[model samples]
Target: MWGEMLGAAIGGVVAVAAAPVVLSAVGFTGSGIAAASIAAKMMSAAAVANGGGVAAGSLVATLQSIGVLGLSTSTNIILGSVGAAIGAAGASEVS
Candidate 1:
């Protein structure tokens, strides 16, 4: 249990630190989604799915918002929780 907890804490921290960098690498940036990039492709798909516009709470829109304004506290917490769950699972497997 302790091992899992430690792993979870570390994983959460790492995920929080890495999320923005990862998002940026995939073409999600402060300015906007980059053309000819993965982000653009995702947006295009989302727009098509929503009949010519990305839905307000769609994945692409949420990601773009994160890219521009960064994760909100709730979203940060959710990400950390997911990371924690994965880390705990990994730790348990190792043990």
Candidate 2:
């Protein structure tokens, strides 16, 4: 139980801190989605689905927004929660 909590805490922090790097790795950057990247591919798909335009509030758009503007407080909280859940699950499994 203690180990699980500890893992959860660590995972949450790590996930929050690494979000930017991970986003960048996947081609989401401040300068917009990188060419030939997964982000680009997603954008293309989204545009095709939405009649050649990525709709506002869509996943692709939201991600790009985050990439450009950085994560919001609520977003950080959500990320941390997800990370905590994953960490707790992993720690529980290990124990």
Candidate 3:
């Protein structure tokens, strides 16, 4: 019970503290992600305009081509797991 809380606290702190160093070492940045997403959206818009077809599938495929869809899915999964962990830790304390 308490152990889980301690584990969550320590793990959260360590992950937060290490994330910047890890991200920087790997040359990942929020700005880069945002720029890529904007580029992908623009590309999708251009493709739709050129194709003269407003099919949603075409836009999805265009975004997927730029890895936008895949990255977003993976990010959601990772964040969901972290949220679940944090939520569980809190629940344990209440119970």
For TM-score, the strongest prediction is 2
Please list the C-alpha lDDT of all candidates, in the order they appear.
0.91, 0.96, 0.50
The TM-score, computed over Cα atoms with residue i paired to residue i, of candidate 3 is 0.32
TM-score of each model, paired residue for residue: 0.80, 0.85, 0.32
Question: Against the true structure, candidate 2 has what lDDT?
Answer: 0.96
When sorted by lDDT, best at the front, the candidate numbers are 2, 1, 3
Q: Candidate 1 — which residues are off by over 4 angstroms?
A: 49-51
- The 10 consecutive residues of candidate 1 with the worst lDDT sum are 9-18
Of 1 and 2, the candidate ahead on TM-score is: 2
Residue-level error in angstroms, candidate 3, position 48: 21
lDDT of 1: 0.91
Candidate 2 is scored at a TM of 0.85
Residue-level lDDT tens digits of model 2 in 1-95: 99999989998999999999999999999999999999999999999999999999999999999899999999899999999999999999999
Q: How far is candidate 3 from the true structure (C-alpha RMSD, Å)?
A: 10.1
- Candidate 3 at 64: error in angstroms? 20
Per-residue lDDT, model 3, residue 15, is 47
